[model samples]
Every structure is written in structure tokens, then in C-alpha cells.
Target: MLAFPRPASSAFYRPDIDGLRAIAVLSVIAYHIGVPGLPGGFVGVDIFFVLSGFLISGLLRQELLATGSLGFAAFFARRIRRLGPALMLVTLVTLLAGYMVLLPDAANTLGREARAVVTLSANHHFMKHAFDYFNTATDLKPLLHTWSLAVEEQYYLLWPLLMLGAYRAGGGEKALRPTLLAVLLLSFAACLSLSYSDMPKAFYLMPARAWEFAAGGLLAWLPLRHSRSAWHANALAGGGLAILLCSIVLLDEHSMVFPGWVVLLPVCGTLLVLAAGGLDPHHAPGRLLGSRWFTALGLLSYSWYLWHQPLLALGRYYDVGQRDLLRDFLLGGVLALFLAWLTYCLVEQPVRQRRWRCFATDKSTLWAGLAMSVLVWLVASAAMYMPKKYPWPGYQAILQVKQDQAQLPPGCDMPERGVPLSPQASCRIGPAHAPLQLLAWGDSHTDHAMPMYQLLAQAQGVGILRRAYHGCPPLVDAVPVGEGKVRSWCLNHSRAVMAELASLSRSGLHGVLMNVRWNGYTALPVAGSASITGLAQADAQGNVAVAGAMLAGVGQLDRAHSLQVMAASLDRVASQLAALRLKLVLLAPEPEMPLSVPECLARRGAAACHASRADVDRQRAAILPILQQVASRHANVRVWDPIARFCDAQTCYAAAAGVVRYQDQNHLTASMSRTLQADFAPLFSWARQP
Candidate 1:
């Protein structure tokens, strides 16, 4: 245990610290509003955490040294008075605004977040939601910023008790310092470990973040004599500010390692600033921080933090394209400042100053805080369950139609690697005892057609094996590129499905239906190396004679040649299946809508819920020619066009007969798939024959 000299008073008012607060809050606001220069402005939260730990620990240490005891009730009462009123006001206003602007699903999510905020469990809630703090979607969440406040509150809830225990156990402040240092080291280690494996845990949990606070607390507990040399103070503060500015400018959302070792930059910088100011108030850095503008901004910082997010979120909600982003951000900032001033003067100051006699006593303040929390929770709950009335008639029915889309059938399952594909039975639809007549192979597009296939199989007394992997194309040689790298799982799954198809073909499977989102394979770059266009260009330049060698037997090709070889691989597979006397049918791409069917119908009327035929034709042109060329080379292969079922001369219907055709933008709803039975009758009729 280390010993230290106690300071004169627990509460030391520092205008410089308030200026630091102004810097912290402004950086956060600038980052949230998408300011161009400060991509890493989120480090402001780290500054706040350090400041909080220093102030609170210093106050507690002084009380213990002066009174030789802790007043738990009085301390909690002060916290409630300071935090409760402003929090409740912001939450109420945000909730009301959210109800008016947000969709039903988004509104329901807000209500759940509100409940979590009231109980100081918002961090846990957001973690469960798998929220990425730096993602674009986070901008729409009005209460997302409250997670930091929750972390601070949760820390305060238990930190004082722990300090009191340590004070009694060790008999002085000296003994507590080493214990806090050990805890800080351990927490930082945890943060590093979890950040790599489980980012949400490291990002949102208090334990992983406790080291930052403990760093501040340990600084407060240490004995530091005021530096008589003004040069030392100036250098320390100036260097700290420089580090903070660099962190704000250099990092971004795309940086993989964050809130880990990288966080040391901002945390250490903040510590330096605090230390320098504590040592010399009249130093160059200290004098600048204590200036009038910085001090006033610091006074309003708390309220400003509370108001900024909601205003920005609402602004984004109303302005879809964010036309003139700079103007919108400026307007939002101005509104936030106005609201922050109002709340600070009207609510925060009054409550903290005990202007309301009802909350004059500690017990009364606690009760009042709890009562307000309960009222907010009730309002949030009401908002969540409030009857949602859509502007368009029959919208409820369209939603119901989407909901009725069946899940993956009982015997059909696609588990991740190392898991059994299916447990109780084979991936077969129709009669259990019947022989396998048809095999559906592709990606999720095949999964979407399962209900229709099941109906067809039962009517024709034929067993169908549904073998599909989500997002894995049926092509033998191609791999998916996601997040700028080849998806190994997609490659592995494709090989596995192709092996299964070969085995099933040898067992006398009558036919195979290849159903995939063909456009995805053609347009998306393959394995992050080359796209279909690049492949075609290579062939055109005589670098890789893909078209000339279309009928050549399979051979080992360079990895860069994989995407270019996909069309040839499809033709080769078709030829092999044809040799085995099995039929091959390729389902043409469906007309994908630009937006979800429900969103389109609700935003625009049902009469406007159709896509232009020319757009669909243009999008499918590249893939259609490839499919046609493959079919032309094999006698057993045939192409099935579903466009005639949905499109007229100039338009493709998204909804018909009062039913939505799509569950989302691209996939067909089960209800809509079932309605395609007439078009599918011929395939079943062909299978039913001897």
C-alpha cells in the first residue's frame, strides 16, 4: 500500500476541466453528425470516462478523509438530482418524436431501448441487438448515445461501495491505490482479449471499460506536487491536446483494432491534460481551457450530449437522401444548442439547486426519481403497443401474407460446418417411401420455391430432394466475395453440393432443377479477384481463351481464372448430367424489385407497386445469354422463363389479386410461390410419367 498527502477539499472547481468537457462533447457531436475531419471523434467518450472517474473518486476520497465515514444516501441523492431530470426530459422528447417519424418495427425497438435506459441496462440491450457502434445504421437510433451514460451510472452504483470496503480493509488511501492499479491492468487485459474475439463484449460491457475509469481514479489518488515550472505544464497540456487531435483525425470506422490497445492514445492524453491543469492553472494550456467560451460550452456539455443525438436522428429520418448534409448538420447543431440551453437552465439547474421543495430531502429525491422512471417506462410501453394504422388500405393483409411465408421444412436443414445436415430424415419432400425423382440445387432461391415443390411432389407422388445453401451459387468453380475477401464457407459449400449432385445422379435421379440468383454471381466480383466482365475482357484480349475452350474437359486453372470458367463449368455439368440420361432445367432469374413490396405499397399506392419491364430485362441481360448458351450446347438442358407469369409488355407486377408477390426485395413469398402452381404443372406432369 502507498501513502499520499490529502488535498484541502474534495470539491475543486476547475474551469479548465470544464473546457476539457467542452472539447469532449464537441468532438462527439461532430463525429455523430458526419463531420469530414474528425472520423475518430468518438474518443470523446474516453475523455468523459476519465473525467468522471477523477472527479467522483476525488470527491469520495475527500469525504472519507474529512468525515471518516461515507454518506451513501446523500451521495446517491445528489447523483439522482443531477442526472435524473435531464435524462427523463430527453428520453420523453425523443420517444414522442420517434413515434411520429419511425416505422412500426423501429418504434418497437425504441420502446425496448427506453426500458433498458430507465434501468441502466442499455449497454446490455445494445449488445444483445448486435449493434456495431460505428455502422451507418447506428445513426438512426436516437438513444444509442445513452449507452455511455449507463456505463457511468452502473460504475457509480458499485464503485463507491467497493472504495468504502477497501478504505475500511486497508485503513487508508495508500492501500486502495495498489488494488486499483492491479484491477486496471486486469480490466485492460480483458478488453484486449475480448475485443479480438467478441467485440460487442469489449465495446459495451462495463468490466472491459473499467480500466479507463480506474486510470483516472488512480491519478486522483496519487500525490503530485504542483509544478512551479510553467514550461512543464505548458508542454504536458500541449502534447496531450496534440495526441487527442491526432486520434480524432487519423482513425475511422474501418479500422479493425479499436477500443483495445489503440484506446491508450486518448486515455493517456486525457490523463496528461488533467495532470497538467491540476499542477498549474495559469499555464498556457490551462489558461486557454479556462477561457469564457470554453467554460460556457462546458457548462452546457451534459445537456448538449443528451439533446444532440435525438435531433440528428430525427433530421436523418426526415431527410432520406441527406441532401446538403452540411446544411442539415449545421441546423441540427444549432437546434441542439438551443435545446441544451433550455434544458440546462429550466431543468438541470433547478433540480440540482433544490428549487423544488418536493425533492428537498434525500429520501424524497430518490422516490421522485423512481416515480419519474416508472412513468417514462409506462409511456414507452404504451408507445410500443399503440395501434399502428397504415395510410394505405389492405396493408395489414399484405403484411400477413409476408408473415405466412413458411420456414425451412422439418427435414430440410442447412447447418454450419461440422454439423449434421439433417437429423431425423433425408432432405426429401413428399412421400417418405417414394424414390427420389427431382433434385433442386442452387442457393436461397431454391429454398424459396420449396413450398411449391412440396405441393407439386405430393400431387404427382414423386419424392424431391431440396439441397440448397444460402448465398452459395450452384457453379462448381466460383466463390463469393464478401467484405473484400473470398468467403471460404461459400466455396466449401458449393463443392459439397456438387459432390452430392454427382452421387444422387448415379442413383437414378430423374431430373435436376438449378435455381439461383444468377445476377449476383455475374455482377459481384468473384473471390475478390475478378468479375465476369474482367473474365470476358480477358477472353476478348486472347489472354484466356474461355469461349474457345468451352467444351474442353475440366483441368486445373489458375485461381484468377475461376470466375471466367463458371459458364463453361455449368455447360460441362449439364453435359455430364445429359450423359446419365437425366433432365436439366434452369429457372431464369425472377424480376427483383428495388424496394421491399410492403415498403413500396405503403409509401406509394398499390397502383404504383410495379417495376418497369425494361429495367428487369436490362438487369438480367448478361446472365440470360449465358444460360441460353449453356442450354443450346446440351440436349437434356432446358431453360424455364417465369417472367411471362409476372410481366406484361412494359411492366412487371409486384402485387396481384390483392396479394404481395415478394417477401422482400428479391425472394418470392410462400403464398406467392404457391400461386405459381399452374406454371409448374408441366414439370410435375413430366415427372409423373413412367
Candidate 2:
């Protein structure tokens, strides 16, 4: 076989490598599209991670050993020459598709993703938004999977210099082994530690990812550094293959903390196979992975990886709320094959052959790619984040304090709080004298609802006092985000909200308005990522008992018990509002779409969340039982149901006379809330309070 020109060597194209690529690609596809019977399929990407480290490090290491001072510029030029053309073509098409098909918010999200993609920081973005992996807020984000590419790029940026520095600073190739081993061990240990403690961190962070790549690096460097017997290589290959097979077939969903320690199985497996390359073709395990068909897929693997995620994400994007695992998998495979063919022809072959060598050699050319990518990233970021303008000018400073506790209280166990207060964070409602003061509070549920509350308050003399805790629910029934540590915060915040309510009730204040979209106490976000064998729903026996106890606790707070607390609060606020009668109203939160808004918005046609009156009726009926019960218990509470006011026989919608009602489900646009006030504010005209 003639040595084909790979940067590392003029070596013949390895066929079985494609087989490994096929294995990796298929596994990731199966895993992501929610195909049954392959829960561990995500490990396929781990396979790619290992392979990439080995190949990239192999090339770099070979050059370093062959030449004293590495040709870093040529090395980078070759990478850009090889990977850039295909990547740019794909990204441009994806961005174009984003502009057309995506919803406004989805477009914003894709814009952010575009920014992250161009900047190569998608891993960090995903990690920050990791808490709600598929929250209603982010379910339709098409570029979510680009985190892997970010990881690869991150590894590429750091690893080359580290290897080069190690080679130069120490005993060259001979001393390189221990340095790599130590770094690998440290990274692997970090992964192991995070896996046991923080699942999300382990899943996304770079430290946790280093070992897999290092395992590959070590494998690539091994054979040249030391000689091993044919029997040793064969046994290594066979054992490694067995480990890989066992992991895919035998492992279940129970051990999801993978690519941490569990990744060793496959990384070691690949290592064994590569190490065995010095053997005869008939050598058992070596021959299998090295087979002609396997190598073909390996050859096309880069194109395949580029093709698969977009196909799968797009398929899910189109499907929206509906999950069709099998169909998505099938479509994913077909689209991948199609894309891989196109990429191989249009990008991979031409670029790899340096047909456009003129651009590759010119520093200005690479600089152009970088400059364009950065400019696009900046523009996309600007598009995604439109700064919020406060309706009331002076309130901006008050609302600007970023709320850390922006979600639900952890376990909702506070026994001390009698009246309920939403754990809503810093909110600047209308001036202290605003006759109508509406309070929006909860977890981020509270945070997201603030715009609607503000619009309503501004028009209705309703002052909006915003307080939201992240992961802390407004409901005493709401559980903490994860486990025990959160329970204390949940209890304390609930206690605070309850105490605030008691004080307000006694202050003779204008009606207190409250809003929270309390579904998760009974419902989970629609994404399949959140799985529970027996999540206690609202009507669940255990949940009902808990709710009953919570109500009983609130009911126990009589005027006599709250007198001292209320008097102190009244004294403090008397000068602020000066003896104005306080009215309490429970704002009936609009119903959310059964699916995420992006998922709903991504709908091309009428099945989009244009919830007809019938749909509102059904939703209201489902949650009415809980909503009314809560409202009924509160003293002097009035219902501000958007359904009753906004829906008129046919549909509850954005076209509510001169106002665009919804930015998305369950949240009203600022303008819509103001418009609705035109109709509803007169109802508050009867109030004698401030």
C-alpha cells in the first residue's frame, strides 16, 4: 500500500477505522433520538472522543519526534484546511435554517448557539444552562449537541501546546510517557470525583473529559516508544474488544456517570486494538475492528458526526411535542448518510487534498476565517439578548439586583411561616403609593412571570413586588431541586413568604396580587430527560396528604397570633403607603403549553399553541381544582383569570385588540398586559385603597 499523505505519515487509509466511526455514530444517534434498547448509546460519542485524541495526538507527536521545532503554523493550516471548509458550510446552512424556521425565542436561542459555535464555547454555555437541561425554556435549542465540538476544539487548543512544551522542556519523547500519565491520572480522578458528586458537571466539564483523550494520546505514543510481543498485542486487543462489547450490551441506564470511569472500558479497548496493529491480519480481535467495512465508516466519520446531530435535532424540532423514537432514529440514519455523502464530496475530499492550498498557506486566509467567525458570533449574541427596559423608569435600578434565589425553595418544609409569600427576588413595583400592588414570586417561575405582572401593575395602579428564588417553588408542596441540602432553604423561604402574607393582610393594604404557574408540583417538564418511576403528582396520595398539612398550617395563623408581626410591619410601611387598605388578589396564571414554547413555536402550521377556548377550558379544568382551592383559602382573594377575560368562545390569543397577547405560553407580553388593563383596570376602580 502506498503511503497516503496524512500529516503524521504518508500512511494508507485505514478501513476498520471507519467501522469504529460507524459504531460511534450509530450509538450516539440511537442514544439521542431516544431509541429503545440502547440507553448507553451516548457512549458512542465517547468513542469518538477517544479516537480523536489518539489520531490528533498521534500526528502531533510524530511530527515533534521527527523534527526538533514543530511546524505549528503548517500543522494548524492543515487542520483548518481539512476541517474548516466542511464545518463552515454546515454552520452557514444551519444558521440560515435557523433564521427561517425557528420561533423568535428559538431563533434567539439558535443565535446564542451560533455565537457559541463560532467562539467555540458551547460547552460553557450548555454547562451554565445545565440545570434545566430540557426545561420548557430550552427544549428546542438545535445547537445543544455542539457542546461536543466545543470539547474537541478545547482539547485541540490546549493539548498541542502541552505536548510540544513537554517534549521541549523535558527528555523529549522518552520522558513524555510519565508526564502524560500523571496528567491523565489527575484528570481521570477529577472526573471520578465529579461523577460521584455533581452529575451535570461531570457530564459537561473539560476536566472530566481529559482522561478519555489522554487515553488515546497514550495509545498513539505507546508502540513507537516501546516494543511489545505479538502475543501481548493480541491479548490486549481481544480483552479491549471484550470490554467494549460488554459495556454496550451489558450496561444499563443505572450507571449514567459515564465517560468518567466507565469510559476506561472503551478507551482501553481501542488502545488494545491499536496496539495490536503490529500483528497478522488474521489475528482475532484486530481483524474485526480493522475490517474493510469498519474502515470505510471511519474514513467518513468526521462527515458523519457533523451530519448526525443536526439531523436528529431537526427531526425532534419538527416533531416538537411528539416523540417518535423509532422514526427519528430511522430519519436520523438516512439524513446522516445523505449529509455524509455531500460533505465527503463537497468538503472532505477537496479540502483534505489541499485543492485550495492557496488559502491554506496564506495567513490572511485563516485570519479571515477567524475574523468572520468572531464578527458573526458578536452579531448573533447581540440578536439573542435584547436588554429589558423597565416600564417604570425609576424601578430599573431596584430590579437590577440579580436574584440568586430565583427558583423554588428546596423542600418546602418551613413550619414557622403562617402566611404565604412567593420567594420572588428583587422587584420594584410601582411607587409605594401605586393603588394596586401586585406581587410576583416563586422560583424562576416567578422570575419569568414578572413581565406580565409588571404590565398588569403599571396599567392597573398595581405595584409589582418581585421576589423569586431559583429552584425554590412558591408552593409549600414543591420539592427542592435535588436532595437534602436544598430542603432547609425551601423551608426558610416558604416561611418568609408566609410571614409576609400575614403582615400584608393586616396592613389594610390594597389587594395583594399573586401569580405563579404551579404545574410542576403535579407535572414534570415534558422532556424525556427527567424520568422518575413514581413521581408524586398533585393528587397522589402522599402529595395530597402533604398539601392538606400545608393548608392546615396556614389556616392555623389567626389574627391574634399575627397581631404583633403585622403591627411591626404596619408601623414600618405606614409612612410608605400611610394607612391604605390592602386588597389581596390571586392572579390566575395562564396555562402553559403541554410542551416547551420553542417546541410549540417550532410548529410550522396551526397545531402551534393557539390554544382555543376549548383547550383553555380543558387546561383550566385540570388545574382549577388546585387553583380554586388555594384561592378559596386566602382571605379576600379575588380571581384575575386571564382565561375568563381573554378567551371569548373560540380562542385565547395574541390578537386581543391592538395587543400581541403572548410572547409565548403562560407569559404575557408587556404590551398585551397593558392592553388587557384597558378592559380589566376598571374592575379595580371600586377600590378605596391608595
Best by lDDT: 1
Candidate 1, residues 381-449, lDDT tens digits: the string is 976766254412344654565575746656566666513445324677787787787888788889888
C-alpha lDDT score of every prediction, in listed order:
0.74, 0.55
The alpha-carbon deviation from the true structure for residue 114 of candidate 2, after best TM-score superposition, in angstroms, is 2.0
Write down the worst ten-residue block by lDDT for model 1. 548-557
Error of 1 at 463 (Å): 7.2
Per-residue lDDT tens digits of candidate 2, residues 1-690? 122212223354444455567777767666666776766666777788888887887888888878865776676666666666676666666666555454345557777777887778888887765432323233355667678778877877787788878888896887677777877899888887765555456667777888888888887777543234557656866776677667666655443444446767777766666555534333566567666566556666677667666666655665654557676657567777667767776667766665655554547447746765776776576555532321223323212222211232234322333225423332455545674334444554455545445555555555555555544444433333321012335445644655565565464334444455433333323223231111111221212222111211122122222222222322232222223344444455574544433234434433455566776676555445544554455434455665666666887653345443444445544444545454545434433244
Evaluated at residue 40, the lDDT of candidate 2 is 66
Query: Cα lDDT of model 2 overall?
Result: 0.55
* Residue runs of model 2 more than 4 Å from their true location after superposition: 1-14, 130-139, 223-239, 249-255, 258-260, 278-282, 319-321, 325-331, 359-365, 368-433, 436-438, 443-472, 475-511, 521-523, 526-592, 595-690
